[model samples]
Target: MNWKKSLRAAGLVTALTFSLVGCNTEGSYSPQEIIDHALQETKEPLTYYGEYTMDMGEAGGKAQVKEWSKDGKRRIETISENGEHNIAVNNGSQIIMYDVVKNTVHKIDISKDGLDDFPSQRDQLEILFNTVKDTHDVKIAGEEKIAGRDTYKIVAKAKKNDTLIGDIEVWVDKKTWVTLKTITNSAGNKMTTEYTKLDDSAKIDDAQFTIDIPKDAKVEEISVPESESVKLDTVKEQLGEFLMVPEENGLTLDGISLDKGIEDRSEYTFNYSKNGQQNISVTVFKANSNANKVEPVFGEKEMDIRGQKGSVMDENKFRSISWQENGYQYSIFIGNSELTIEDLVTYAKQMTIVK
Candidate 1:
């Protein structure tokens, strides 16, 4: 329970259960109907305290979480191993995160920063359900009892064998439609999160949604720079030379966006689309010369493109090829396309850095 070490893993559970309000609806519903009802029920404001456990095959941890939300305002407090307390409060406009051990607070402006929607129970569920509904096959796995409550077990299995999400099983409470337990298998590793105690009827004070930072604590402002859309010539003027257009492949330049990179560098993205449906992007950026060379991940294989050795990573949703050339790293991503590894390599071979 090193709080700092286990904070991220515990935060996932907190995000998934931030504002689950129960509904009064009754009657048997299809698995999708139940999920839809649960997603809709999250629109109401409620408070809850629960104990969550996360078990990965090799590592696992637990945390105590208390959350309160009304309207768009939210506050979540997580106490993990070593009594590490992390507090996050979103007052509709800005998000403030306090680290108790470090005695510091970080504030982020949601609108100005282009941040994703605040992690409300509704938002989290929407993202989870939408991703699975389109890519995975969903069905009812039966019924079970979780934490003394009746629940319907719903299973979502990946449609393709190469997907990162192998399978996910969720036990939805019959009365509240809240997820009591979730088991996810990805990349041959299983992780399960279960709520041992759920108190949705608890009285939450207004003070719980506000954080009282010590006067001596330091405050830091975090800003996320906006991505800049630029033309190809502008990119070449900055990075000298990189990949050019490949009109031969029926790929046309859709747009280019630039963003801040690590170590004060810049990242350039070249977006290409085919028939306005299929999209392929080539991203080029600098890497530290002394940094360890990139290695292939699971399911990646060695390949050669334009005399440069690289690796091709093939997954269910997207296919990517990455390599280092002329002191810069380049990666090409093809999303939901029928392009083969050889097809991608052919495109990679045509990339040239202008002098």
Candidate 2:
């Protein structure tokens, strides 16, 4: 495992822990008192709607989603050329994913309720009232300006047993206790989360949390894949595009060559132009490896070029990372490359994913 990525993820997770504590701690109030207040707030139901853009590390660019929610769960709907999909999730447990493309449904088991489940933005505000237990050192680093509003900066240190996450920094609204920015460095990748549109209040409905499973929807169990190494010739055959071998650290880089089909998919694929900066690679995995005679490709890991951490999709097995910026998104799968760290990051920065 990449300690940097693990540490960075720990940092982000620590920030989340503090965010939950902040919600439990009212202005100049005790953490326990704040949580009591938050529990009371949950009695009233609410919802919200907004636009969300997720920045997927080296995968490149941003993933845009129009959000809608009701009850206590939040769902994000994304439409790809294949079909529409919805990801319904709450922090630790209660994760529901729907793939209209394949017409599939998946659920997860969680020990506790996570903020990711809340349908209302107000729920985020209310969580500040709950528990204030920290296994490590935590401090309020004063305040900063976020979207014209004053926010409190909270920093946390690493714990002895905490190996995956190192440090975390969070920017929370001083007035509303809402998280304006969250930065986490885990597994070698640095992840940042920012929330906006607080000043504007809108109407949210209950239907957002409801899942009307299509009559034809297929039920499937989703889990991380376990695959070792990559085969060059097989990758070339799986991916419909021609691949060119790029040079880096004396290791061979297998990637998709620019072609007509790739050019055609560029529009719906999001941003493909700016990706020239990073060496781009592609891999095609068997969609139904568990049932049919299919081969799965486990992407390789390289060192970070921009000081960002490497990621573990499934405990260093079948994993992928994405990066988004300037209205574009790019994703690189490890099963697509066989280059060393220096060479991989050099080209990973050039790819993009758009839609």
TM-score for each predicted model, relative to the true structure: 0.82, 0.41
Model 1 TM-score, all chains together? 0.82
Cα lDDT of model 1 by residue, 221-305, tens digit: 9875667999878887887866654666577888889877655568888888888775678888765788554433335667886
Where in model 1 is the C-alpha error above 4 Å? Answer: 1-24, 41-43, 46-49, 55-60, 111-119, 129-137, 158-163, 187-189, 293-301, 335-342
lDDT of 2: 0.42
Error of 2 at 221 (Å): 6.5
The C-alpha local distance difference test score for the whole of candidate 1 amounts to 0.69
lDDT score for residue 105 of model 1: 97
RMSD of each: 4.8, 16.0
> Compared with the true structure, what per-residue lDDT tens digits does model 2 show for residues 1-355?
1222332333234333122212333356333333333334444233445453444354233444555544445566654332345555442345677776677888764444433433234443332211113433556677688767777676655453322333556665555454556665544455665554443255755556657778998876644322234444444444434322235343344333322222122211111112233333443222222333212222223334234544323222223443333322334434323334433445566433221
Minimal lDDT window, size 10, model 2: 266-275
Worst 10 residues of 1 by lDDT: 1-10
lDDT of 2 at 157: 55
